[model samples]
Target: MSVYHRPVSNIWWLKRKPYILFMIRELTSVFVAGYCIFLLVLVYKLTQGADAYGNFMVALKLPSSVALHLISLAFVLYHTITWFNLTPKILVLYRGEERIHQGLVAGTFYAVWAVISFMVVWLVLGV
Candidate 1:
């Protein structure tokens, strides 16, 4: 019987730009999940009555919370951008004899995302 051992370095992903970006994209999920949980808590607070919701808003207004939210927003934006860029690879489009350009596919995704996001904001604000 023969035993083989392999060692993995902590900064292995650092060896390549793509690998680092991939790791960052994977880690962005944690921040996204955290933001989702934060929203859920806000919803729970709303259910608890106006006072609870007010308190939660106040807590969120704190500097630390603001910082966390900003950091989370950055991660979410990066995650979204990477996913949008990868869409062409995940979804193939053909124009009869030729395939659509990757940039066009990604641009379409961004346009739709922006439109939907704007609609959501408008609906939420009633403005």
Candidate 2:
């Protein structure tokens, strides 16, 4: 005879879901890739002819298409941040044979992204 026990305390984060989060985060990466490929294909089709371009726009009007884009946009935002957060683990940065903190690296990535975003907007909008 055996019994399983679940913790009752509200340590919060430890008690929360992980597998679901992992799946969501992984799916976000897939969406990011798929979204880019989809845009590329749409561009290619639009360049082919008016009929093909009309078909693409018609597909966009479908409910499934709208849902896909909405989900993709949400996932993409999460993916971007997660990618920055994971950069330190993937790359080796040693000033004098010592590893750096992941947060520091991720912060740097966020800073760079912000600066580039600002610059691009400034150039595009003439600000």
Candidate 3:
């Protein structure tokens, strides 16, 4: 007996709203990873001494680089928001036999994100 295999269409994910959003979230992860690699390269350039690091910073200030960073930031933000929303489902916390509210769970994550972001900004600004 031969096994029957179902053929999947390339645009199958586009058939539904949830599927489309899920695919986009997964796609954004690539941009996030690319940004991480970009940071690693930045660190490597910094270790190469002042001139190399200065040149890297100069390139980053270009319009094309700025646009790419903005686009990546948007995707990364979406990826983060969706993941945070899903955390409540993945992690169910019980409080004295009663389950904690999903909003509170997600809100806690957002609060932590805000605090960390503030800290980073403060450090970057030397304030």
Candidate 4:
């Protein structure tokens, strides 16, 4: 018996807004993983000693490295915002038998994120 197979175009995902956004989100993950690996390398360099860590920091300040970091930061932000927006769909909340609004749920996540980020900045700056 022969199986029926549907032909699909290479750029099929680009045809729709949702598909394009989904593809962009998936692509952002690569940059996110790359950034994670970069952070891990930074940690490793720190463990190697002060001189190695200092050199690593110096390298990171180079124009090419700064550009790469900026690009990665943009992708990471896109990935994070998209995922947070999706949180409501993935997690349904209830407040005493009443279904909570999706916007509220997503906003809660953003609020928590902002609080944590502010705390991190405060700690890092020692202010």
Clashes of each: 0, 0, 0, 0
Instruction: Work out the TM-score per prediction.
Output: 0.89, 0.59, 0.90, 0.87
Q: Show pairs that collide, candidate 3.
A: none
How does candidate 4 fare on TM-score? 0.87
Residue 80 alpha-carbon offset, candidate 1, angstroms: 0.5
Residue range 1-127, candidate 3, lDDT tens digits: 9999999999999999999999999999899998999999999998999999999999998999999999999999999899999999989999999999999999999999999999999998988
**lDDT for position 100 in model 4:** 95
Better of 2 and 4 by lDDT: 4
Residue pairs with backbone overlap in model 1: none
Per-residue C-alpha lDDT of model 4 across residues 8-77, encoded as one tens digit per residue? 9999999999999889999999998999999899999989999999999899879999999999999999
Flag clash pairs in model 4: none
Which regions of candidate 3 are displaced past 4 Å? 1-6
Which candidate ranks first by lDDT, i.e. highest? 3
Can you give the lDDT of residue 102 in candidate 4?
96
lDDT of each: 0.95, 0.85, 0.96, 0.94
Ranking, TM-score, top scorer first = 3, 1, 4, 2
Taking every candidate in turn, the Cα RMSD to the unseen true structure, in Å, is: 2.3, 6.5, 2.3, 2.3
The superposed Cα distance between candidate 1 and the true structure at residue 97, in angstroms, equals 1.7
Best by TM-score: 3
